[model samples]
Target: MLDFTKSSAPAFQNLTPAQFAEGRQQPGAVLLDVRRPDEFAAGHLPGAFNLDVTASDFGPRVAALDKTRPTYVYCRSGARSASAAGQLATAGFAQVANLLGGVLDWPGALTTK
Candidate 1:
């Protein structure tokens, strides 16, 4: 059991691409994209919800997500979402993780459909 409370928040899980893909398919997992509006509109994983961490209401917006579920966070290049993941932890989310390199390292294609 990982003591997420005692362990450092925002610590990279550094998942393999395959593991990431699998995680995405799991039930009760949320994909959180913390990129800016423009960047998110450009490209992002299918089904990932945009929360735009830079927005003033980021904390409240993220609070709407299911805290009991695991949240997989990403940004354009892995920076912003790492911070968001930490914030999620502090806000009482138990299972949260940051995509190691964000969407920049994702090998899959993006779609707006």
Candidate 2:
């Protein structure tokens, strides 16, 4: 479990694209794409679920996730996922990892749906 109380603010691990990819493969890990619906529809990491950080229900939506499981978050650039990761940590998520450079720097193949 992560020690979210150690600092004034919650901290989330920032993983490189390759590292993020490996983490995504872990059993029961959730790959969350905190991008807008349009952006998510264009292209996203395989198996990533769309959860727009800008949505009005962002907090509620995030709260609905399984906090015990590890969550891997990403966005167009890194900003949104960073914010989302912090939010998840604040929400008592045990494990949270943010993609360092987001999809822009992701080396893995993306899926459009």
How high is the CA lDDT of each candidate model?
Answer: 0.81, 0.93
Task: In model 2, state the lDDT of residue 46.
Answer: 86
* lDDT tens digits, residue span 77-106, model 2: 999999999999999999999999899999
* Model 1 superposed RMSD (Cα): 4.4
Judge candidate 1 against the unseen true structure and give its global Cα lDDT, from 0 to 1: 0.81
Looking at model 1, report the run of 10 residues with the lowest lDDT sum: 7-16
In candidate 1, the residue pairs with backbone N, CA or C atoms under 3 Å apart (3 or more residues apart, or in different chains) clash, namely: none
Worst 10 residues of 2 by lDDT: 2-11
RMSDs, each prediction? Answer: 4.4, 4.3
Residue-wise lDDT of candidate 1 within 1-113, one digit each (tens)?
Answer: 76756856434354555677787677988988898888888888999889999999998887887888878888978788878888888888878778777788889998665
Q: Candidate 2: which stretches are off by over 4 Å?
A: 1-6
